[model samples]
Target: MQVTALYRHPIKSHGRECLDAVTLVTGQTIPWDRTWAVTHEASKADAAETAWVACHNFMIGTRTPALAGIWAKLDEVERRVTLTHQDLEELTFCPDDPEDVAEFLNWVAPLCPENRACPTGIVTAGTRGMTDSDYPSVSLMNVASHRAIEQAISGPLELERWRGNIWIDGAAEWEEFGWLGRDIQIGEATLRLREPIERCAHTSANPRTGQRDADTLGTLESDFGHQDFGIYAEVVNGGEIRIGDKAVLQ
Candidate 1:
């Protein structure tokens, strides 16, 4: 298989940006992936806490599908992010700035439903990125598996719903399931497959429309007999990975 695409979500459940290439670091997430996560009113975390934690403390795309409509591009040099959504005007500001934080919170308010927990704060837990898993991990997805899902659903679906960090093509459908604890090399990086990623309702939400139009979980259970779509991997050896880089199981 080859690397078909690369993506990173600077803010968890906020937006994803495409990358042509990136340098992977050992025991780290995709560069800037989930670096800034929004906390909700329902969270039980200490405001000052700064370490990788569970997903329940954060507001994510699974619960607020409308947030899926947000798209983002990060200015790494400026330490700022430019965000765009259909319902709101474009905004660009540094997330670490108090003034910008307040502006961003207000700007994103309409996208969040009134009935659900409102976004209350922005939090970061160092550089590991707030991946759902306890360990610093990257996600790998197979295009063939995604196609299988489309076949099962009998409809078109966006792969962005999966929010993967690295996407590979040319592998057989569900081939990744067999790679648990196996070593795979992509470009100059060597990653150890940790486990299959049991999915959530987040996959049901369309990234472009921010609508839950598909029963992804149902189709997975019925057709595949499992509610998994991807795999989590730890970067055992860090290196630069680019589009079309070969992925080989070793």
Candidate 2:
């Protein structure tokens, strides 16, 4: 197999950025992936701490599908995030600045449904990323399997819907399921296939339009008999991995 793509989500439930290469660290999530999350006003997440919290405390695609329509660019040096949406003016601000945070909240509050918990501030957990899985992991996807899902639905599905960190080609459709407990080598890094990633309603939203345009869960249940679309792997040996790197079962 070969690595076809790489991605990083600087902020959870927001936007993603593509990378050509990355250095993997053992027992850690991909670099800058989910480094920040927009916490709701009533969220239990403590900004002063560095512990993982439930995803519900933040503005997420599952709760606010409109977030998918946003594109974010993180300027780490400036400690600012630039959010752009087709229907909204471009907003750039520092989440660490009180005044800027309030500005950010004001800018995005309208996009989020008031009935749901509204985002109030930004939160982070030190160096670790806030991954969906409680454990540090890198999500992997099979291009063939994604194509299978699209074929079953008789429509095109954007890969960003799944927000995988690593995408591989050359694997048979759904073949990664059998890889549980196996070790896989990609470029110079080695990872242990942990478990199949369970699916969620967030997959139903189109990343390009921020609308619930597909019944991804329904299609999965009806055709595949499960709501899983990818796998989580724990980095076992740290090394540099790049797009087009060779992937092999070890």
The prediction achieving the highest TM-score against the true structure is 1
lDDT of each: 0.90, 0.87
Q: Evaluate residue 67 in candidate 2 and report its C-alpha lDDT on the 0 to 100 scale.
A: 87
Q: After superposition, how far is residue 76 of candidate 1 from its true place, in Å?
A: 0.8
* Model 2 misplaced regions, further than 4 Å: none
Enumerate residue pairs that collide in model 1. none
lDDT of 1 by residue, 1-250 (tens): 8999999999889988999999999999988999888888777654643787789898887888888878899998897999988878999988778789899999999888888888887888768799999999999999999999999899888878899999999899998998898999999999999999999998888788788889999999999898988999999999999999999999
Model 1 vs. true fold: TM? 0.97
Q: What is the lDDT of residue 87 in candidate 1?
A: 77
Write candidate 2's Cα lDDT for 155-181 as tens digits. Answer: 999999998999999989999999999
lDDT at residue 10 of model 1 (Cα atoms): 95
The root-mean-square deviation over C-alpha atoms between each candidate and the true structure, in angstroms, is 1.1, 1.3
Worst 10 residues of 1 by lDDT: 41-50
For candidate 2, list the clashing residue pairs, or say none.
none
